[model samples]
Target: MTVAVATIGFTKTTAENFFARLKAAKVKRVIDVRLHNTSQLAGFAKADDLAYFLKTINGMDYVPEPILAPTEELMKFFKTDKGDWDVFSRDFSALMKERKVEKALKPSFLDGACLLCSEATAHRCHRRLVVEYLNKEWSGALTVAHL
Candidate 1:
């Protein structure tokens, strides 16, 4: 079975559209990769709220996987540097390697799992780096579909 990788940011989507998109994508679970999931800024995407909605509305499991997130300090540095993706990706990639996420990652969990964050797009999200790193580490077997 192909292990799919999908990325989504809840900020740009409504609760209805968010669940609909996951359902449309046939996602079985959502692995939240945010460092701070309960921030008031998250609004509907707050950890508890998001989990409740995913389970009740979409019949999907919600998992908080902080290992896939960049360190708060790193994020601060990135924002301090004015949203430099190059620096962010470089440091975040190194962090994943140090954390041995590949060894910890359960391929079965990713069969229909989507990575969740707050960025509107994967272009600048560390979740994208995580997906790419896993793809490379696992010999490119993963099919990444950013939602």
Candidate 2:
């Protein structure tokens, strides 16, 4: 069976809409993939609050998996150092390869799992790259949907 995975971003969205979307998608768990999930800008998506919200609101689990996140250096290069999308994408892909994220993760674990990030959408987001990388490693075992 194909492992189903979803991706979502918190920015430019409301708490009500966010939780509702997850519920609508039947997401069983949320995998927080942000390098900085505790930032005040995270608001409703903050680690502790998000965990509580997921459980209390959707009866879902929250897992912080920073290993899937881009490194500080990579983030800086893309956001602060003015690196292009192509460069960031290549570097982030290399980082994921070097880290062997595919081996670290199991398809079962990702089933019904949704990747969480700060961007408003998966386009131009590392979360998209992550799912793509994992799909490749798993020989197209994953069926990804961006929420």
Candidate 3:
């Protein structure tokens, strides 16, 4: 069976819309793929508050998997270097390969999981790269939905 994995970003969206989208998708868990989820800028997306809200609002589980996140150096390069998406994607893909995330991450954890990040959309986010890399590694077994 093909595993269904969804991706979402919290910026430029309201808490009500965020929860509503997750509920609509029937996501069982949220995998936070952010390097720093507790930054003051995170607002409701902060780890502790996110966990609480996920449970209270939609009865969903929250899991912070930093292993799926890009390194600080990588993020700094992307943000500071005028954001070259191709170079960022190439480097991030290399990082994931080096980390062997395809082997380390369990399929069960991702089957019904939603990858969470701060980008308003998946077009220019590491979360998209992550899923694409995983799909390639898994032989296209993952059906990725960008939410």
On lDDT, the candidate that comes out on top is 2
lDDT of 2 at 41: 66
Error in Å for residue 137 of model 2: 0.8
Find the candidate with the highest TM-score and give its number.
2
**lDDT, residue 140, candidate 1:** 83
Error of 1 at 50 (Å): 1.0
lDDT of each: 0.86, 0.94, 0.93
Q: Model 2 reaches what TM-score against the true structure?
A: 0.98
Report the poorest 10 consecutive residues by lDDT, candidate 2: 37-46
Model 2 per-residue lDDT tens digits across residues 23-48: 99999999999999996765888899
TM, every model: 0.94, 0.98, 0.97
Which segments of model 2 are wrong by more than 4 Å? none
Model 3: residues with Cα > 4 Å off, grouped in runs: none
Q: Supply candidate 3's per-residue lDDT for 119.
A: 92
Q: Which lDDT tens digits does candidate 3 get at residues 1-147?
A: 689999999999999999999999999999999999995655899999999999999999999998999999999999877778899999999999999999999677799899999998999999999999999998888999999
Q: Which lDDT tens digits does candidate 1 get at residues 1-147?
A: 568768898776677887888999999999999998896655779889888889898899999998988897898888766867787788889999999999998677788899998888888888889889998888887899999
